[model samples]
Target chain A: MEFSLFNILDLLGTMAFAISGALAAMSRKLDLFGIFIIAFVTSIGGGTLRDVLIGNTPVNWMENTNYVYLIGVVTILTIIFRNKINYLKTSLFLFDTIGLGIFTITGVETGIQNDLDPIISIALGAMTGTFGGVIRDILCNEIPVLFRKEIYATASLTGALIFVLLDELQVNTDITYLVTALTVISIRLLVVKYKISLPFFTLDQKKSPN
Target chain B: MEFSLFNILDLLGTMAFAISGALAAMSRKLDLFGIFIIAFVTSIGGGTLRDVLIGNTPVNWMENTNYVYLIGVVTILTIIFRNKINYLKTSLFLFDTIGLGIFTITGVETGIQNDLDPIISIALGAMTGTFGGVIRDILCNEIPVLFRKEIYATASLTGALIFVLLDELQVNTDITYLVTALTVISIRLLVVKYKISLPFFTLDQKKSPN
Candidate 1:
């Protein structure tokens, strides 16, 4: 059933996101409580926002307490392997990208089920894929990388568009999901590998008046 | 009906929050687009989050576009009277506090209507009262004031608690709303007047091992 598939993917994404958040918190030298909070929000923030916006109350994680236990386990592991995890940046990146792919698909599909406009659906998908990290960076006292012309949101947006288009073309659901996720993961990897970015705007550099 | 009161308060709060957001953006020297975007988010971020969690979709601002116009107008006014407005800091603070009061009441009432737990309702109220500024601060690349042991969220929480308690005691709705809003506003003003702040902890100050 779709629920089982979503459950698996959601758990995987939560673990990956939790690890990323814990690392971020460690880097910032946050307290134990801060680390836990950051990890929880980073893992669930995007989906929480998406669910709220789509009128799904008591959100997914609120209904399923297991996600909390999973995040706790991930955070503890992250703390224990702090130094080792830092050295495994590439692995972390891959894990995070995988999460992004799965979350984007779920977000887009949820939007579709809610009968949202296609553009809004794609936006929801991109938001679900990226806003967790955005919240994470913000809590760490940094401008979100998403707003800094990073190729992050772009990758998710592209995947969401592809998924919508493929569905319109009568593609198989499984194949559509697979292709969309893979496309996002590939784009993310390529962007990072090539140092590719969107146009960078530094507003402070200009002296233009409003 | 409470609906009319909420509608008017909501509009006023939107304007105040929008102006505060515009001022923050201006202080950061963001471009016009950045100013507008920050203004929009700060005006609606908290309410949007609350509505989403309460299963309200398309969000209130999206459903009622007047909030957009109000923000746009507020942004333009802030830009045009930048220097003059900067000198009116006290007035701005009062306006922001008023918004916080009304938004808190609305948030708590919505939670009550949705049958959320009393504690959760209070939390939602505090979130509604403070999160617009939190999001604004984050977008401005600063640690949110809400997390910094300010007397901010505390004021909202106290008001929310009082509102819930009074409602449970079979208090008149009008008196409950007035008392709650006034309490929040009074606490905020007193806190500022007395330079009161909760104990602040900076994690980086510690050299504790993970």
Candidate 2:
């Protein structure tokens, strides 16, 4: 199938999410099926939630089984390199950050097609990028990185708003998409690089170490 | 709040699910927060998925914070009794069975209210009873019991179909609810009691003995 740049990005985003999930499974020392489950949920859980919210019948994964195959390969790769790739943590982080940015844009695009307002689109975009990881963490019985890690939904929110704002200013959709994706990835990567975090409600660091 | 018999049953059902989730967490040796997450999802995850499917906004648990506190208490109780309650496994199974049954009926009822066909209601009911565990298992990085344990959902499907059949025969709604709940609970308990399992698609266990 001839995929547009956006479609290609969507696949990349999915691959990234799946890899992150597989990495998490490796960390848990889970079995093969366990690795696949985490990868599948991490890659698709957010999009599935969004589809349900938008009343998309059959869901995207059910619509296209290719997604299933993609995640399958993702699990195999992570399993094969489980120990060797631990040192490539920086590269994995980059993949995850880039994937988050691309996925956020894809989510906003989905929301717009359904006629949601910009504010809602921004929120949906962030949800699309983040909730899968939250679900993954919850399954792994850990506090969600999105809930406690640095500048997560905030970065997606800003990028989504940027896309919406640029569109309102009559920018071409393709350019808007590219700009938003770059903006999101940059902000996320820079935050991680600099140990920057958004201000959030916290009782005390002693209370929650995660 | 005004409560009907079924409503009371619903509360118990929620408590049962919460307790099951808490116990699962306890078995895994999780901390207080992990137990809380398990209890919360086990209690509310199934219905939340159903509601989202039917386009109900804000979700059920989001509207009722009381249930959150209820799950909180249930989790604490599980934590406290973790060592002592291994002997009470049968009672716990009974509670889980009853909870699954009532939950099935409740989900089907909502689907019927939305004017979905009875077949869809049957599906909704099964989804309601099964999805929380699916979500729970997925988060815990395991293949959902649904994929491997056929009888787990078969009990729900049978009970849901029976509920529909009783309604078709103009059975009183109250009696119908009672019979359906009992039927599901009975089937589940009996299955577990007898070590009954569904034959695999190949009539051979697909899993490695390892």
Best by lDDT: 1
Clashing pairs in 2: A139-B139, A139-B140
What TM-scores do the predictions have? Answer: 0.58, 0.58
- DockQ values, each candidate: 0.13, 0.07
The worst-scoring run of ten residues by lDDT in candidate 2 chain A lies at A83-92
DockQ winner: 1
Evaluate model 2: give its TM-score.
Answer: 0.58
Candidate 2 accuracy as lDDT: 0.75
Worst 10 residues of 2 chain B by lDDT: B201-210
The true-versus-predicted C-alpha distance at residue A16 of model 1, in Å, is: 4.5
Best by TM-score: 1
Per-residue lDDT of candidate 2, residues B176-206 (tens digit): 8888888888887787768776532111112
By summed lDDT, which 10 consecutive residues of candidate 1 chain A come out lowest? A83-92
